[model samples]
Structures are given as structure tokens and as C-alpha cells.
Target chain A: MPQLVTVKVNRPDRRPVRVWVPVLPVALVLFPVVVLVVLAAIVACVVFRIGVVRALGAAWRVISALPGARFDIEQGRTAVLVAIR
Target chain B: MTEQRKDILDMLVAGKITAEEAEQLIAALERDQAPATGSLDARPKGKVKYLRVVVDATDNGEPSRVNVRVPLQLLRAGVRLAALVPPQALVKANASLSDSGVPIDLTQLKPEQLEALVEHLDEVTVEVDSPDATVRVFCE
Candidate 1:
């Protein structure tokens, strides 16, 4: 009974699961957003050209109506000459 | 009247006339409406100065950028279609801009938008002083 021996056993450590993780959904969603931005820019350019041309057409009509303001318009271009007051 | 005399009168009105020339101008006005006849043929088409305006696509490739250099008188007319910021309106619109120099930073105005604002802007006209030709820009 006095000859009994006690032995301590070392246990191997276990790794914990990583709970906080980065997801790529935000980046996945950004691709269409960028595409939409490009499309919007294209649309804006078309609208601007139409507006400018329309504005020029309207201006040409008005200038032609003036008595002394010499003007000409063709192929969407205009020229005007008026003596300074 | 001689072109020289007319120019001199213009200089007088422009406040470039010297004190010594005051007596000469007064005497000339009183002496005769006609100027010395010989100087009439000396004028060269009244100095047809040309102003150039170069327009480029804006960084965003939207309205565009228009750069112009003209006789200050023609600047307003040539860019007549380009909107001018009246000092008061400019001040109001560009309230975020610094009070010194020109009111540029605050407006964020595009060249085409400015052109649209002009009351009666003739299309982009490039007058060639070299050969008296004009190149017009059109929207396609």
C-alpha cells in the first residue's frame, strides 16, 4: 500500500472556431452600382447634347426675328453679327 | 474724318488722352468736324482682332470646358450663349467661394450648361482673322 505511484497526464490543446469573419457581399453588390453610374453618365451626355441643340435652334429663330441682328443657321450651326450699341 | 482722329477721340473717351492733348482735341472739335484727309487710307481694316475659344470635354465627359480669348468686347458677344454670372447672382451662387479673384470654385457650372443659359447665343463660331473665315461647331 505505501508503494503506490501518482502520474499526471498532459492534455493536448484544442483550437477555437473563428466566429468573426469577413463576408464579400458588399463588394459583390458594388459591381452593379458601378455599372449603373456609367450608364447614368452616358444618359446625361445624350440629354445635354439634345438640350444644347434645342436651345441653339430656339436662339436662331429669335435672332432671325431681330431687325438689325444679322444671323444665319444651317446644319445645326449659327452665325450672328450685330453692330454694338 | 481721318481714322487717326477718330481713334484719338476714342482714346480721349477711353481716358488714355494726355493733358497736353486736351487743348488739341478741344481746338480740333471746334475747328472742323473733318479730320486731315491723308490718314484715311492708312487704317488696316480697323484692326480685325480675332478671339479664339477652345472647348474640350469635361473630366466627367459631360457638358465640356470652353476656353476663350477674345477682345474683351467680343468676349461677351462671342460667348453670348455661355451664361455670364452677374456679380450679384455670382455672389449668391458662389457663396462658398472665396471673395478674392474670380468666382470660379463654387459654381461647378459646365460649359454646355453655361451655353444654355446665354439668352441668345449664336452657336460656337470660330472667326479666322488670317483669311476672314468662320468655322462653326454643330451638335451631331
Candidate 2:
């Protein structure tokens, strides 16, 4: 599995937020919050007759496109795993 | 009592129209002419123009200023547009932003969720000043 990376973003007009990416599904230290959120969304899409692999693959592509944002890994993975279960 | 006189009396009793004005109004009414209070146009003007973010800083020894005029409606439109974005796209953006040092969850943006956040911010001014920079946010 790629290490999940967590990203933190602080906005002036909105609440501070975070995102997560599973780095190549191999960078074990990456766990981003948005990754889990997207995971849930992908499942929802699948439930709605969408393709799971296609959705997951698209999500990975998004995570790959981010700029040099900060990321966390270990904690995000636990959260993601818990969310999955 | 005449209808116009009654209105003036009501205003006087409610302390809206002054006593002298009420008397004048009543005298005007006695003359069988209507009086114009002219209160409608007395409303205060100059509503908030923009949500302004002014950034004054010296970057590399050169003074620079950034004025961000974020329309209230743009925030609404942005949040609405987010919903139209597929979750996969958001996930990709999230990854990209995280790598760029922005740790924000793009998937959580919703128009309704921003209502309270924007409400408390309306008309509020936030100022931050450092040795090299000053940042001001307000509804101008």
C-alpha cells in the first residue's frame, strides 16, 4: 500500500482544513484526510452504479497533481483504515 | 381627528416625530393639505462595497501591496461550483495542495456549510501587523 500523506491548509476566510494522499499506494508514511473523504465518496459513487476502480484511479490522479503541500502519514492511515472498516 | 393628524399623533406618541413637528403637522392638516415627512430618503447610505483583504509587505526589500476584493457572491459561486466537481478531482486537488504545504480538505466545501462562517465575518475587520507586513480584512 502507498504511504498516505496528510496536507494542511489554512484559509483566511474559511476554517483550516486538511487533505490526504496515498503516495503511489506505496509511500507508507502518507495519510491525508481528503483521501479518506474521497474514499467514502468513491464508495458512494460505486453504490450509485459508478465504477469503483475508475473512481479510485481518478482520485489517485488528483492527489498526484497537488503542489508542494505539507503532508502527514501515519495518523492518516489509521483514520482511513478505521473509516474503511 | 383627521387621518393625517392621527398618523402624526401616532408618530408623536411613539416618539418618532417631535412634538413641535407633530403640532406643525396638525396645523398643516387643519389647512386640508398633506405634509411630507421626507423620512424615506433620510436612510443612511454607503453600504459595504467589498470584502477587502489588503496586504502590505516588503518582499526582498521592495514594498509591495496586495488588495484582494473578494465579492460576497464569488464565495457563494465558488462553493456551488465545488459541488459540481467530481470527488476524484477534489482528491487530486487535495493531494496537489498538500504537497504544496496547504493542508485543506477540498471535499468539505458546501454552500450551506459556509453560511455561518460568512455571517460572522460580515462587516468584521481583521488586522495583522508585523515588522514587515500589515494585513487587513474588512467588508468595505
Candidate 3:
């Protein structure tokens, strides 16, 4: 799982900007809220006859897969890059 | 021949098993081992961790480039998520896709099948070149 994300942006005649985002602290802060929401969702799924376990598994899979993703776009003198690690 | 096949042939020669039985044994061996041996060439040497797309184009004398690398696990996750969609929603989606000329059935997309597709994706590479642009897509 990635603990950090980096973003860089450059534009014509403008200062290049770069930022680093730490994901662990944010994830920790949201952990309890996520747990609560998940529990509620499970209950709702049970009531609605949905596949709770499968939905939870899928959500976890999506979260675990977010790392190692990168996007870069450059046009003329402008460029933007976002990377997760 | 594999040791198993040789053993089966030996059994046939020693009259321990009938010729038909030996043939059946060999067929079974092949059937059971197809994914393990026969498909080895098709399988990627290393686990594919990412899918990458790159495009370089010149438009009106302005050069532009795009590069994207997506985790392959995200694709697997998305496929798994598809399994959770309601049948009614899938039916509607299928109809919309058909109307859009996709001709695909979301209902028939099994996770296992998608897993196999993902495994084989590493073997696929697509490249396109034109006067103004070059595009490449591959797994790594």
C-alpha cells in the first residue's frame, strides 16, 4: 500500500508547483469513520438482501490497488504529473 | 515425454494397464497439466504489476504527450466490484452498451473469467503510429 502521493504541475510563464501528500495519517484519521460506515452498510445490505461480503471485499481490493499509479500529461510548455507510492 | 507419460507407457507395455487405459491416463495428465506446462510460454515471466499507456502527438505544431501507469490490481478490483452490481442494473447497463454498439453482456462477466483475462493481458501489447501521433499500451 502506498503511504504517499506526489503531484507536480508546470505551466507556461508560471512557477512550477510540487506537493507531497502523506496518506497514512489521513487514512488513520478516517479509519474509525470508515469502520462505522462499513458496519452500517453491512446492516443495510443484510436488510436489502445484497452481497455484503462481496461488496466489502471489493472495496478493500480497490483501496489496496491504489498504489503504484501515475499519470503525466504534457502539452507544449505545460506539464502535470501525479504519482502514488 | 514427461515421467508420468513414460510411466503410463511402461504400464501399457508391461500389460499392467490396457492401451485404452494408458491413453486415457495420458489425456488426463495433459488435461491436468495444461495450465502448468503448456501455458507456461503464454504466462508472463514476472507478475504484471501495472498497465501503462503512452501517447505522443503533435497537433498544429504543438507537441503533446501523455503517460499513464495504472496498477493492474486496480483492474482486478474493478472486475470484482462488477460482480456486486445488481442484476437489474446490469441488465440496464447491458442494454445501454448494446445500444452503443458494444454488444457485451455484463451478466455474463464472471470474476474467474476476468481473472484469466487479466493474467493473459500481460502478453498483449498494442501500438499505433500515425503521421502526428504514436500510442502504446502494454502491461509491466
In terms of docking quality, how is candidate 3 classified? medium
RMSD in order of candidates: 29.0, 17.2, 7.5
Model 2: lDDT of residue B11: 97
Task: Report the lDDT tens digits of candidate 2 across residue range A7-66.
Answer: 454434566566565555543345576578777887787666566665565555444333
Q: In model 1, which regions exceed 4 Å deviation? A: A1-54, A57-85, B1-34, B37-49, B52-78, B83-93, B99-140
Residues B23-140, model 2: lDDT tens digits: 9888867666423444455656546534667777777776666555655544444444444466777899999999999989888876577755665566488999999988988875
Question: What TM-score does model 1 achieve against the real structure?
Answer: 0.20
Q: Which ten residues in a row have the lowest lDDT in candidate 1 chain B?
A: B131-140
Clash number by candidate, in order:
0, 38, 0
lDDT of 3 by residue, A1-85 (tens): 7789999999999999999989989878999997899999898778756788878888889878989999999999999999998
Tens digits of per-residue lDDT for model 1, A1-85: 0111122222225332222212234335687986786567456546555344544544444333332221221111211222211
Docking class of 1: incorrect
The candidate with the higher TM-score, 1 or 2, is 2
> What is candidate 3's TM-score against the reference?
0.72
Q: Taking the candidates in order, what DockQ does each have?
A: 0.01, 0.02, 0.60
Off by over 4 Å in 3: A30-48, B1-44
lDDT of 1 by residue, B1-140 (tens): 66757777788878898856966976776567444453575544333233344444323333333333333233334344344323455556566555555557534665565545442233334433323223333211
Which ranges of candidate 2 are over 4 A from the true structure?
A1-85, B1-47, B100-103
